[model samples]
Target: MNKKPNILLIYTGGTIGMIRDFKTGALKAFDFKNLLEKIPELQLLDCNIDTVSFNEPIDSSNMKPEYWVQMAEIIEDNYTLFDGFVILHGSDTMSYSASALSFMLENLAKPVIFTGSQLPIGDLRTDAKENLITSIQIASKQENHKPLIKEVCLYFEYKLYRGNRTTKINAEHFQAFASLNYPDLAESGVHLKINKEYLFRSSLNKNLIVRKNLDSNIAIIKIFPGISPQVFQSIFNIKNLKAVIIETYGAGNCTTEAWFINLITQTIKKGIHIINITQCSGGSVIMGHYETSRELIKAGVISGKDITTEAAIAKTMYLLGQNISGKSFKTIYETSLRGEIT
Candidate 1:
């Protein structure tokens, strides 16, 4: 008989990690040591489950590069002991965290599934149970004694998405996340469905390389009808700013005004990488597709292609952390390293 996969459940704090106390009538952090007691269905999975909680769990809103490093360290330290990891996180910033992890855990050959819920674990109508249970199942799935999943992913509302491709699109609904530019990697329904073709596979021979030094010296500027030169000058003039992601209009199009083009050209000349990504959530940024975006192309703005803004930020930080040369930054950013861009 085959030995069951060992799964590590990391509770990083979120609505899913809270339970209602009947006596006090207030939500409190659920004791993950009693996880099996809270959700006995986990007992039915064909895996050995273990639990780890943050010393002081934090809301996803408070998640930062340091927290991401903590998560990566946990995975690195126990990588040999666990076949997979399932993180319980908040829905609000889950995509950002997930995207950051995808870049941090380089050459990852095991599943790192991030999941959360629109409701608390103790709620009568909680979606947490299903999400948590199915994520573990997906993570533990094996073929010929090897793990089935080989990359970081996000599981929510029965859909499995490539972590970096996902974005939180809804706050008040059960389906809080969406991967608009990419197809679902897997789905959970009557039977858990794995779209094998869509899955990201890594080489087995290479060891996992954890990237801890993520540079957060980046800013995002969204173009609006009346965005002034003063506003643009202030942002570009920020001290030690490494990169800026411009959320331009449709297909990476922006104003053709001389001042706007000159500012972007000057910024790129000063060694600060300027990335052009579309403001629309569902489409790729086709730079220079129209006359409006031509100046951006001429000014040497790197195109983000189909990358989500969250992923763009994470990717930029990760690349900058590597001390990638200014000459190679644009070339590398336009290339998809973690399948983040199509």
Candidate 2:
């Protein structure tokens, strides 16, 4: 007989956890102790659901690296007891949190699906139940007694996106997140479908290692027309700054002006890694394709390709935490480490 998969639902606070008080019509935290009753559909799945909630619920806007480390600790502590994990988080920072977790959980051999809803769980029109239900189903999916997805992923609005590849696109829509550069790993419809070709392949021999230390001394500078020298210098002058993400114009194009080019050169010389990422939503950074961007390539700016700003920040923090410096830093950042970039 096949043993039912044991899935752990980590509720870190969000709209998904909110339930309504029938008397007052106001929302309150859904009691996870009665989660099975709140969403009875879960009983139909061939899995055992256990839950763990944060001691104090936090708005996603206030989420920080400490919270991320706390999450990693929870997963690491329960690694051997659960076959898969589902996290209920706020949509505002879901992509960032998910992206951070993807890098933090190294060589994962089981699914970690992050999900949330746009409306309170108690609302009749809420999307929470479906999201919560499907996330567990995806987490529990296995083949030949082995897990199907072995990476951190965000499942929102019926699509399973690589956590690092996703970006929140809309604030009010049901489909708030999108993976513009990379394809969806799976999609839910009349039938939940898995795109096997897009899933992250893992080595069964490797153990999952969680990295808790994250360096936060970084900044993202968006290049704009008429950007003054004072403004540019102010960012570069940030004390102990290790890296910066330069949000260049389309195709990584930036002003070829001497002041701007010189700043890039000076920043690189100071050992601050400058990554040139396009401000455009769906295109890769082709640094040397244009005359304007050629100087950036010459100035030793690392092309961010199609990686989202959220992932860039998270990846930079993770790499910086590991003290990965010198020449190889650019090589590692440019390479597609967690399928975040093309």
Candidate 3:
């Protein structure tokens, strides 16, 4: 018989870790050490599970680069000891965390799944239990004693999505996320069916390497109708800004106005990397394909292709951390690093 997989459950803080006080109707942190007590269903899985919680739980809104580094460190420290890892985090920024981790962990050969619940676990009708249980199952899945998934993924609402391609689309619904440009990695229904063709195939000989340095000195500028040149210039001219993600119109088209083109050109000349991504959810960025976007391409803006905004930001930070030059940075940004873009 094959040895059962060892799964690490890292609870960073979210509704999944909460339990309601019946009398006071207050939600409090449930001790994960007694995981079985809260979710006895976990014992049903054919794997050994261990739990870890942050010393101080944080809301997703406060998640930062330092936290991403800490998460990477934890996985790095425990890389060889476990078969897979499931992170319980707030859904508000789960995509950002998952996307950041995708870039941080290179040559990953085991599943690193992030999951969280929209409702508290203590609630009778909460989605927490299913999300948590399935995430663990997907992480522990193996074929020929090798991990079935070898990349960062997010499991929610019976669907497993590529971490970097996902975006949180709803706050009230259980289906809070959608991978606008990528297909679902796996879906849970009568049985857990993985789209093996879509799975990331890592170079088996490569050892896992964790990237620690991340540049948070980046900004996102979303273009809108009647946007003022002063406002655009102010953002583009931020001091020490290393990168900017310009959310452009459909098919990566933007204003053909002279001032806008001048600002972009000047920004690029100053060594500030600019990435042009689509504002629409379901399309790829096609820079220079349209007359409106011709100026942006001429101004040296990098095309983000089909990358989600979350992934674009993470990719920029990852590339900036490498300290590459402007010309090379654009080349790397346009390429697919971890299935974040086409």
Candidate 4:
């Protein structure tokens, strides 16, 4: 028989890690050392689990590349000793964190499942236990003795989505996340069904690589009606700005006026990368689909295709930090590096 898989639970602070003091109705972080005591159901799983948490956990809003680097290093240090990893992060910025990690971890051959709850684990009606439980179950999934789910993924509300493709769409519902362009990788039902065809199978022959450097000198420009040239120019001219994700209207369109194109063209000449992403959650950016967007393409605006704004920003930072510049930078940025774009 095959040995039980060793799963690592990296708790980076989120609602899922808290427990309530029922008497006072207060909540606090649970002791991971007594994980079984907190969640006895874990002992029933068909794998062994070990957990590591951040020394001083912060809300996901405070999550940055430095924390991302620390996460990568933790996984790298324990790569061989574990079979899969489940990250507990705040859902508020989970997509960005997941997308960042997807880029930082290259040729990942094991699952890096990120999950969190909309409500505290200690709350009687909390969604934490199910999300946490199912995530661990998915992390332990295997086939013919080889582990399944060899990529960054987000699990919540009975669905597993590609990490970089996910976006937290709802604040109150249990189904808080969505992967608009990509199909669900797995779903939790009576059987925990996995769409085998959709799982990303990397070449195990390639050793895992962690990218540490990330550039934060980026901004996002969301185009709106009657946006003044002064306002647009201010954002575009931010000091040392390396990249910008322009959230255009439907189908990657924007103002067709000559002045807009001139500003875009000038920015491109100055070595600033501008990515065109649709504001709509469900459609790909077909730059030349409309007269409005065609000028952007001509002005050297890179297409984000079907990627989300969160993924776009994270990817822009990642590519910029790599020192990839000019046409080569655009080419690489336009390509789907982490299955982020469909």
Q: Which candidate is the best by lDDT?
A: 1
| TM-scores for every candidate against the unseen true structure | 0.99, 0.98, 0.99, 0.98
Separately for all candidates shown, the number of backbone clashes (residues 3 or more apart, or on different chains) is 0, 0, 0, 0
Off by over 4 Å in 1: none
Candidate 1 local accuracy as lDDT? 0.94
Task: Write out the backbone clash pairs for model 1.
Answer: none
Candidate 1's residue-wise lDDT over 1-342, tens digit each?
A: 899999999999999999988798899999999999879999999999999999999999999999999999999999999999999999988999999999999999999999999988998999999999999999999988989999999999999999999999999989999999999999888998999999887866999999999999999999999899998899999999999999998898988899999999999999999999999988989977899998888889999999999999999999999999987999999998999999
At residue 118, candidate 4 shows an lDDT of 88
- Winner on TM-score between 1 and 2 is 1
lDDT of 3 by residue, 144-232 (tens): 99899999999999999999999999999999999978889999999999999999887787999999889989999899999999997
Q: Show where candidate 3 strays beyond 4 Å.
A: none
Estimate every model's Cα lDDT from 0 to 1: 0.94, 0.91, 0.92, 0.90
Q: What lDDT would candidate 2 get against the real structure?
A: 0.91
lDDT score of model 3?
Answer: 0.92
lDDT of 4 by residue, 197-265 (tens): 988777669999999889999989888999878877998899999888899999999998778889999
Model 1 lDDT at residue 221: 96
For model 4, state the Cα shift of residue 94 in Å: 0.5
Model 4 / residue 89 / CA error / Å: 0.7
- Ordered from best to worst lDDT, the candidate numbers read 1, 3, 2, 4
